[model samples]
Target: MTCNLAYNPRFMFLTKTIRYNLLAILACLLWSSSFVTTKHALDYQTPLTLAGLRFVLAGLIQIPLCGHLLAPLRMLRKEFFTVLLVSIFHTIFLYGTFFIGMTWVGGAEGAIMIGVGPLSSALMAHLFMHDDKMQRRTLVSIGFGMAGVVLISLASKPWSPVGLKEFFGLMLLLSGAVVSALGNVVVAKRKGGLHPIALNSAQMLLGGVVLLLIAFPFEGAANFALPPAFYGQLMWLAVISATAFAIWFHLLSKIKVSKLNLWKFLIPLSGATLSWLLLPDESPTLPSLAGMALIVAGIVIGQRESK
Candidate 1:
């Protein structure tokens, strides 16, 4: 005799995969638009203060939303300090430098430098972390990525006898990349994942405190008036922080981390496109477009071989 049993359909898994990738792309677009928003917001607020507020608000929003997922205080004791350290280095130091650098550099140049994140992350994985071993194809992919970086940097025109101030700006952004690389390695191969929401929230809180403390010393206290449009801008930034991170971390849970990373190639390309649309003076020249093509190609090759 035949018996019937309740079973979930296999297609559910396929549907989920599609949903995750869709969310990932949405996260990318939201994050890309941040470059433009930050540029606009800088007219009213100092970079450090703005960075501080962004994280503070993000943390506040996440606390009530994810508080239940955190481990008990005793269980978190050992990890508590480590999380704070990573937050300071990765979120505060890295973001602080990037914002300060933005004061001197355009969104286009910043996007190109930030686009090298995946390669930097890969190198960090190979050097410091276990279980994220570099494969031969990954190395080949890295070569392509490096070539793209060279082209993008050349297209950015950093050293055409500009003032020393411009060079310092580049240095700050490059430093931000190094810090972000370190964060990636620190996260790679971590056993028994922390609740992403809890972790991100705590770190953002700590980082915000640090950044805010630094803000006043650098920018001084200004009773600056806000334009009517700043409310819209701030709301956009808040949405970028909350929504992008929620979607990104959710995807990380559902998919292999390495596979999800491939979408990073789209970030700078999107940012470049946004800049082209927004800025009258700047557009993607042929070299910039070629650089983006190389980045995308490298990501595809890397993902195929990473398996």
Candidate 2:
């Protein structure tokens, strides 16, 4: 017997929309896990070195699948430059500050700060993109998400007589958020025929190379030796970076950036949970749990509104 629902165009569209939304959520989850993994990797390597190596590894992993060594050569000059701009904002500035900030802040704290990216992205999209204009519901969702982040940050005591290192870390994390939001706007604004995988690979490779070059002057290449555990963490970070960026860019190509970015509210929740489970010193307090609950609620509301 044929199912009438299967033949219904509206129903089919809804199913596909849900599938794409799920993909965005999955990407958020993968990205959220990075806070913890990056924190672990930082213990064995300097921030710049770790950032450079992680993305370089990720770019190498995606090379064959994206186009081996001929991908960038195939891109038009304009497209190549667009990808380079994306690499600058998204990889070099975003992750570079992120890794450095994580050195001073805890993984959970870093996650909360990064949680601000969704609101930033939404505002940027509304301002810059015609089709991504913000609605009442989006404003409400952003309010909820930002409130949750505020609650988490307060509960985490990020501002109670902040030291120099903590203050610098907070600034860096917020800067990363802004750069990341700008990158999302750039990607959404791009009208190109380049494959998403190719774009992702080129940006990561270029950004990684830039980071390594920057690292050479300040961090140097002397302390490259690390244990087996560090290598494992490095490989895992590479997998996470490659997979998450690919999924995220593909979703950005398909959907509204505002709607897609709403899923990033889950990052703090997931990152905090993972940090609690893995790092004994990073357990969340009761208020932090309440903040996480608000974050989850905000995500749910945003998801429903997106539909």
Candidate 3:
């Protein structure tokens, strides 16, 4: 026999909120680990090639889960164009810069750079989304987050000169974050009228094909043969992309963009922690830890004020 708890409205609401929060946290965990996995995969493949293969695999995996094979065909013209634009910003520019940037920076450092995404997204949403205007508390929280990024950058260059490669990597990462922020705003703006899975699948497939086409011309004579471990890394990265993005899109459909995106602060923390444990070269210094603390504090303040 199944047991049922008496349903109080408050309890039910709390329970639902907890579940959604847990799902968001889980998505962030998977996404954070992706930085390390992408770094590993880059050892065997160029950035564009790796990104193309990863997204193609993820897109194909999502297709069957979409239930209807012709879902894209049913979308309105406006919705189709919106999805295509999201593909360009979200997949092409975001992952292109992300993967290429990782080639120049350590996994943990790259992850820290991605910490800027939520703050930037919040600012963009304040400009574009009527319901998500930034209040005084949000402004303060953004200031804290920005300070944390500054601290992390300074910590990375305490004694030595920052090399050109490192500077370029930082720029690429910032570019990726900005493009990703724009994509988040776009998705939040176009809230209804299409299934999230279908949208993701279409974007991944289209974006993956585009990346591959570009990879062929620019990164000719690409090698596919690699160690067994490299293939494992590829598969894992693909799975992470598929699962994290699916959950993220679903959450975006249900939650306010500003409120939901505050959870992104966890990405850098998780990424740095996992990279420290998994990759010897990615251990965090003292100032980096302090910077992470500040970022976390900013997120806590933002979340409390939002509530």
Candidate 4:
């Protein structure tokens, strides 16, 4: 019995490491591919409804697996308000606007905008968070990063051919980027160590509920009923989101938060690469590639400096 019990932990540790890496890779792929999936879904839905439904559905799936953690809901009393605020930042300010902006923004462009997250997050950390501090090197890297984005935008077909609509869309997406960065900083600095799974579950559930409320008045549910043909796609969206969060939180639990943050730089690049593979005709423009390069350079420099 003693020998068997000892062997059990070794087996479990190996299993967990393998599972964690697999899930991390999957999370990246699923999240990157979300740009394409969102594009497909938009054909049959409005951005608001789509955003709301996606989170709500994802939360529903999570509830069953994570129901036990719900008992600790009361434990989060002091931080409950903080969690709610972050939930809004994610569901409304981040993803809500992101969905709407994606209507106007191509996958590649969306990827580039998303890359702004690391830089924005770093800035927020410097200003507001306790753990991270600012430095000259980071500032310089951020400048290069912004320059890259500016060049990409200028080189594009047109920044705003459709008047304020396109302009507003861009603004909204960028705002989402900033808010997302802020949320990351908050999570990093907040007191106490949360079980990543429980924390993630709570955030998603709260965010999804808020999204439903916002989307309901807009009648987002009306777009959800689809024929058998599209059911596969819906399943895909749900699986991708659920699996991504699970893996993401698991990784967060294992690694140092600062090191994990550096990995976010890959998101935009991966999104663009996947978008190119999935939708050949909608390939990234030369300028977008330039932006990708800058984003990468900025992240490397910024992380190096911060360290």
Listed in order, each prediction's TM-score against the native is 0.81, 0.91, 0.87, 0.75
Off by over 4 Å in 4: 1-28, 64-79, 106-109, 140-162, 246-259, 282-307
Q: For residue 173, what is the lDDT in candidate 3?
A: 92
Measured with C-alpha atoms, the lDDT of residue 94 in candidate 1 is: 90
Candidate with maximal lDDT: 2
TM-score of 3: 0.87
List the global CA lDDT of all models. 0.70, 0.81, 0.78, 0.65
lDDT (Cα, tens digit) per residue for candidate 3, span 1-307: 7545557677787787888788899998998778667767877889998899898888878877888776644442447688788888889898988888888876436655776787788878888889888787776776676667656655654434559997898799999888888888888776775688888888888788888888898887568778899889988988888888888888887777777877887776665577568766666788878988887888778767344
- Prediction 4 TM-score vs. true: 0.75
Which candidate do you rate higher for lDDT, 1 or 2? 2
Cα lDDT tens digits, model 2, 117-198, are 9988988888889999988887788788877876776676555566899879988999989888888888877644567787
How should the candidates be ordered by lDDT, best one leading? 2, 3, 1, 4
lDDT of 1 by residue, 117-184 (tens): 66676666667755566677776776776677567656655545546786788788888877777765
Which runs in model 2 stand beyond 4 Å of their true positions?
1-3, 67-69, 76-78, 107-109, 154-160, 280-285
Q: Candidate 4 on 49-149: residue-level lDDT in tens?
A: 66766776776676556657463364246468766765776566798898888787654355557657657766776777555675677667666666665
> Global CA lDDT of candidate 1, please?
0.70
Where is model 1 more than 4 Å wrong at Cα? 1-20, 67-78, 146-160, 222-224, 249-260, 278-285, 305-307
- Score residue 266 of candidate 3 by CA lDDT: 78
